[model samples]
Target chain A: MAAEVEVVKNKQVLLKDYVTGFPKESDVIISTENTISLKVPENSSGVLVKNLYLSCDPFMRGLMRKPAPNSRTPLPAYKPASPIYGFVVAKVVDSSHPKFKKDDLVWGLAGWEEYSLITETDLLFKIEHTDVPLSYYTGILGLAGITAYGGFYEVCNPKKGEKVFVSAASGAVGQLVGQFAKLTGCYVVGSAGSKEKVDLLKNKFGFDGAFNYKEEHDLDAALKRHFPQGIDIYFENVGGKMLDAVLLNMNMFGRIAVCGMISQYNLDEPEGVKNLMWLIHKRINMRGYSAAEYYPHYTKFLDLVLPHIREKKITYVEDIAEGLESVPAALAGLFSGRNVGKQVIVVARE
Target chain B: MAAEVEVVKNKQVLLKDYVTGFPKESDVIISTENTISLKVPENSSGVLVKNLYLSCDPFMRGLMRKPAPNSRTPLPAYKPASPIYGFVVAKVVDSSHPKFKKDDLVWGLAGWEEYSLITETDLLFKIEHTDVPLSYYTGILGLAGITAYGGFYEVCNPKKGEKVFVSAASGAVGQLVGQFAKLTGCYVVGSAGSKEKVDLLKNKFGFDGAFNYKEEHDLDAALKRHFPQGIDIYFENVGGKMLDAVLLNMNMFGRIAVCGMISQYNLDEPEGVKNLMWLIHKRINMRGYSAAEYYPHYTKFLDLVLPHIREKKITYVEDIAEGLESVPAALAGLFSGRNVGKQVIVVARE
Candidate 1:
């Protein structure tokens, strides 16, 4: 006879409706009406997990908006009144899959809920090392890290002594890219939203220089001051005005890696990048990429990053919230630059 | 003593002033006052050439405008009341440089005059095979051919059966790019301004299909109808609305080789490309390059294209205007798409 499964109340963060402009905490609802069985269904190749950590990412805001009519890759919209999904770290409570068993810790796409039945086992990656904080899997050890790695090393192909510039420098991917540039013996400068984040980038991350973009009235002048010789590699995170200024200040044969356009995501019409003619004059190569495309190299990226973290040569900062109730505000905080670093919600303690 | 060197009348096309908006024939003056020595200067390494053919390119319009204050590469603006300089095929009347002697055929940058004292002989290429038309060196056998070859094969990295599209389909670079795409076994489509040019693209160039972009009211709908599976490679010669529309119809992992943006050149304010978000969604790589960058590969390019010309696998067309007096009108006609193919001025007959 099969063992009986325990059923318990499951608290979830649900999307109320499609968001327009700036997302608010009221856009999502916290509900405790749902229940989950702490066991994989019989004959089902799935895993049941107790959700521990949920990631708050900028891309989530794009998902909140109604998909474009001709959107080639329309990410499935967050269903109204349903649990919102994102990257999460969880402990497996039960498993019918051959690779996972009870108590196997893992991280991948999951719901903002107390418990989740992960039928898409292919997306989940088993956590190998527990010495580090498990929440690191929600960011530094996961997709954000891969994005920084692939975008900088593979896409930009940074050379020693090259001048590198990164926007949103205090954020998850930007911070890591700055450190990676420093590690490769390149001169690195970063721009952030606040004085505190600027100091963090300079003192903690060991960036060559850091600036508060808000304080500078003219972005072009600020860039000219920082990159007097012009930027060799621009790791683009915040697009729009920043991109326009960067185009004017880019060196001949410069490379721009388009990771995300955070500033343009909320606007009804994206800001016009006026200085694109510079792409021709300077012979610039601008390419856009997603970290999900580099999943096959996840293990390669881990192998490169793990040793640096272990030796304290590299460090990661995360702004974390506690419990399922903090989920809405945590996610909304990303757009307003309310979070200092990688934003994570601790759904439950280990 | 050597035969007394003769001084001769030099007919020159001089820019009356820095132009704004659309260029007019009146903006340039045909000067007969200029005189040239039929001999190379003593103790100088310069080669004097009797100009035969001059090429009319869209980039010359940029040279006619006053240099931008913040321009990174301020291409020495055409001085008011001085003859403009452009690519020319000429006969070496006398030489002090070791590479050339009297009567040697060469093609490179020269003044738009009957005679030019070529001091910058380093950029000039000696005509080895007069078997092909010497005029071919002014275009398909010169910069335009290299631009198409390098931009298409090297930048686009096209694969067999990939969908390819070219804007300015009947113009100098676009015509060659269409032929190159067909050579690679790709499904090729082109966009021109007139029905005659469109027919030339389909019949003469052997493109799979062609469209007159001017007749199409809805650019995006035209792109969608033509590229139902979406464009894998877009050889961007005309920018503005065509680029915006192409962005919407691009397949995942599309590549756009930006050789020129003729549509934006004449406008005081260049049009903004709005659908750039498609870059991130589709993971597109858009690169801007110039033929000058590929000069070192000129020999390799000639080796590939000469055989095609001989075998009739490729052919070229030129809208020829006789004498230097027609230089201004020939140049201004480029902006209006009045020239059918490569526009060349017959400065003198071979």
Candidate 2:
């Protein structure tokens, strides 16, 4: 009865089973009954982290299902009795790894539980800038930030004064891409699921123009009307019909940087693209990219982006959900366009 | 006694009307009535040429039809009552231009006639190295050759030890791309419509592997069988089903150079690609290019390829039709894959 108080317990959300169709909140259950020793064992290269914030992304929905047998992605099924892991910002309670230390802040792959023990030290990044919101490490200052940067600059190779179009422009990555394009002297336009998101892209993220894709009956015609000169660069976040429409309105030598295809992920089979033949006529360049492959440029990107954040030259918004129990609703919110900006789950206070 | 004259009249194949469906020999009528007095008017910027050879490419079929009102390409129906113009190897009978003179052999846009009066002098290239066959100028040493070189080297950006797949592998452009990939140390494989072309690619063109696409029931499986590592570069010539399959088998960071879509040109509506979603998953880069766009590099390309031709280091094959009257059948041969190598008509004796 050392303190005569409640033991600090870890809580997590577990997948009850593989999901089909739209995921329901009951597909996952929040449980709190675990504890990790706040000490690193001798000769062990492990770091015990108390997670502070977590990211909720659309791709997480893909991981809810048992991966197809011959799939190339490392999205294995979440064991029924275990916690799910994703990008998280945490405080290292104890560590034996030389690169990290006790009481240091870090961000990497962490479990939904309050505490996670990381064995592989290579994946973790020590947080250097504390002036910005720590929760940002889960979204804008983390994987999503680097993804929007690398996919737009390295993959799309955007030229100044070019016309840029982004799908899912109000989402985490899309919002950043639209802002980046605007900063780069491009005429940036975006498409969102609803009128509210469209307004956010224009007024909040400062996109040059925006449209509600749902209201447009003919996507190709809408694109033609908006981008009369044709799009020079397309940051593809939502695929399917949007991609098909983009193909029809691409200018000669246009570049498409494919980051994600959230629209087609839940479908039983992906939709067919009808305007692919336009690829030949317009002489477009479409390239896909993953952020994990571009980690070498992380420091360079941080140097470039962090100063902008401090100067208030770059602005970010977040939809924060409190407690680990709120993770289910936060994740489900991504598909319905409920998140206003970067979606995050705050687990605990500093 | 009258001069021993052969009547030396210009013979032309005039388009009777804009064609529909499959073109026939009756669509074009060969007549020997037109002659320009075999003279270049004083101060006129024209080169009177004795056409030696004419190229028959699938693009010519498009010229046979009326272009849609809003088409980006200027390709339109051949002037209703005029002779068709295309790539040709010709001897200048007379020239008002400074760079060319009588007896100067040149290759460029010329009428599908025994003799043509070319007004655009800048489009013509004076034959410098004719050590190889003259017909090679119409295929390997001409626009087709430049298309293969620029599209693969500039667009695809080949890396050594990369896996490269080319479609229509035994055609004028495909054979050269395979050879170029081989020279760059890429593991090159190609697909052809027939077994004979497959053998030609492996035995004659030094491709790493070859296959007849027409015989493969499952193109995705075929790609996996040949390229277990997946294709790093795809030189897309045929479109439709092959594109859908290749999308599934492209590696992360793969590049696709869309030079032509021979398969879809004759169709009333272009075939839809079903697996385009794979473009985002693998981070593939697909681009289309035209040889016309590489005009600035033509001199540099000629310097590189002409020497290869002179050394016999690069081999080119041509299927020759004996007269101007054979133009329509030769052009139609492109659609059915009936001609081996480049289908060319010998409009006049070289």
Best by TM-score: 1
- In candidate 2, what are the lDDT values of residues A197-251, reduced to their tens digit? 8988989889989999999999989999889999999999988889988998899
Q: What DockQ does each prediction reach against the true complex?
A: 0.65, 0.58
iRMS per model, in Å, is 1.5, 1.8
What's candidate 1's i-RMS value?
Answer: 1.5
Task: For residues B146-167, write the lDDT of model 2, one tens digit per residue.
Answer: 8999999899999999999999
lDDT of 1 by residue, B240-306 (tens): 8899899888988899998899988888988877777778888899898888789899999999999
Per-residue lDDT for A1-350 in model 1, tens only?
87777999999989999988888899999998999888877877798999999888888887787776766463576888888888899999989988999999999888889999999876799999888889999899987999999999988999999999999999999999999999999999999999999999999999999999999999999999999899999999988889989998988889999999999988888877766777888888999888878888989999999999999999999999988899778877899899999999998877
TM-score of each: 0.98, 0.92
TM-score of chain A of 1: 0.98
lDDT for every model? 0.90, 0.85
